[model samples]
Target: MTKDTPPPPANTEQMNSPSFKLAVQDRDFLLSEPMRGVRFMLEYSKAQILLQRAKIRSTIVVFGSARFREGGPNKEPFWYEEARRFGRIASQLGGALCAEGGNHYHVIATGGGPGAMEAACRGAREVGAPAIGFNITLPHEQQPNPYTTPELTFNFHYFAMRKMHLAMRTKALVVFPGGFGTMDELFEILTLRQTGKVQSLPIVLFDEGYWREIVNFDALVKHGVIDSADLALFRFADRAETAWEALIEQGLDVSVGENDEDLARDM
Candidate 1:
């Protein structure tokens, strides 16, 4: 040996350097706050691709509490059963079973957690209809229910993206008794409708007494904050079939991809 040459280092600094890692494979780099916009886009694009491939032309989104159980406390069982029945009814009559031009309509969509979501997904599966479960990452650990179609089941990191997906294809909305999360979703749709951000969507709140007691739309009208005409934004229903009828009366077309609106907005 000439003894003039220095031995190579024990480790390859180039291989271990963050700069050497591919940007796509660098989790830390992707998750950094500076990359928030990229993360949002990633979440949006992934769900969009899957939904487009599934041919989910429109949806009858069901919102309710994950805490309400089949045989839980009083009225909770009724709410669960009603949500399940509503899911079945929507799938059966909303043209989800019959696709037109390869597009499915009125497919049941849920928050993809338990309680009413599980019940609704269960009902759709029983009818051999595909159901979408938009599960979210939560502090308490939310998991997708077994009843949602495996291919259609999706987990979302951003609530905004999840809500956008939920709103995008929705032809009608049916909300059962719920707590804070449920109210948030309900109010979100209401605000969109109020501001004309979305198409005129038929909204049905199950359990008329409960919804009336919880949210005083009448009070909002009385206070002059919202016009009395805004009261027509949503209707109260006491039964699953009633909700379906309200949706139909409000112009819920059971056809495929026929809405005058664009099927999916690029934004």
Candidate 2:
């Protein structure tokens, strides 16, 4: 009835009490940590979801130089036929595996660039099998091959994430002649295998003649640059069929839990 009570505190429900203000401030601080944690978890969850949804019953990470060009409509690079050959073989193998039903070869994938990458994807398409192209963003180099299967093509911004996706359920790897990028992917897998981060997967280096001569790896072995055991790190092949067979023979259709022991050794 009087102004002495200050109009019943002007409906304090809309205002924060001193203790409530302190509690709110404390919550703001506390929420920051878990908010970051939640973000981390969400990113990880997204990666996991991508991995899970990939139709990777059997996979081969095909690596090759992006410089080579198929004889467009008429003019072609020197390596065009060879690259196409490799692609055809990989496709055939993938198709055969798919024909067997369960756990059969599901997809053939490439770095999703032109040249050799395109060849592999094209090969898979030719054989009527699903193929995936893992394209990356680069400055003025590489584009997703046209042959990539409509259902499986994916582009990635993070190379590490892309690499992880490449190896997620991959059964094998086939590496053709390439520059630094090819070796980068190759060594990445080797490092993963050496440290037991990933189960053993067959790695095929295309072209024995070119590989042996062009690479100084043999010199390293001869000069005691590396241990003999390291020589067993990879196999060499000159033909697409050979690489395909190596992949099939290895039978990496199952996943093994991370081997802490192997990781420890690498460390």
**Residue-wise lDDT of candidate 2 within 1-267, one digit each (tens)?**
776655656658756554456543565644566565554454445644643464244566788888767764332353455556666776554432343333335357777888878887777777666677878878875567889876566666567667876777565788887788888988898787767777677788887776777788868778996666776768887666676676656663323224324322421
- Per-residue lDDT tens digits of candidate 1, residues 42-125? 888998788878887778899999998888989998989988998888888887886444777788999999998999998998
Residue pairs with clashing backbones, model 1: none
Q: In angstroms, how far off is 76's CA in candidate 1?
A: 1.2
In order, what lDDT does every prediction score?
A: 0.88, 0.66
Model 1 poorest 10 in a row by lDDT: 258-267
Per lDDT, the best of the predicted structures is 1
User: What TM-score does candidate 1 get on C-alpha atoms?
Assistant: 0.92
Alpha-carbon lDDT of model 1: 0.88
TM-score of 2: 0.68
Residue 208, candidate 2: Cα error in Å is 1.8
In model 2, which regions exceed 4 Å deviation?
1-54, 72-79, 94-106, 223-225, 248-267
Cα lDDT, model 2, residue 157:
58
Give all TM-scores, in the order shown: 0.92, 0.68
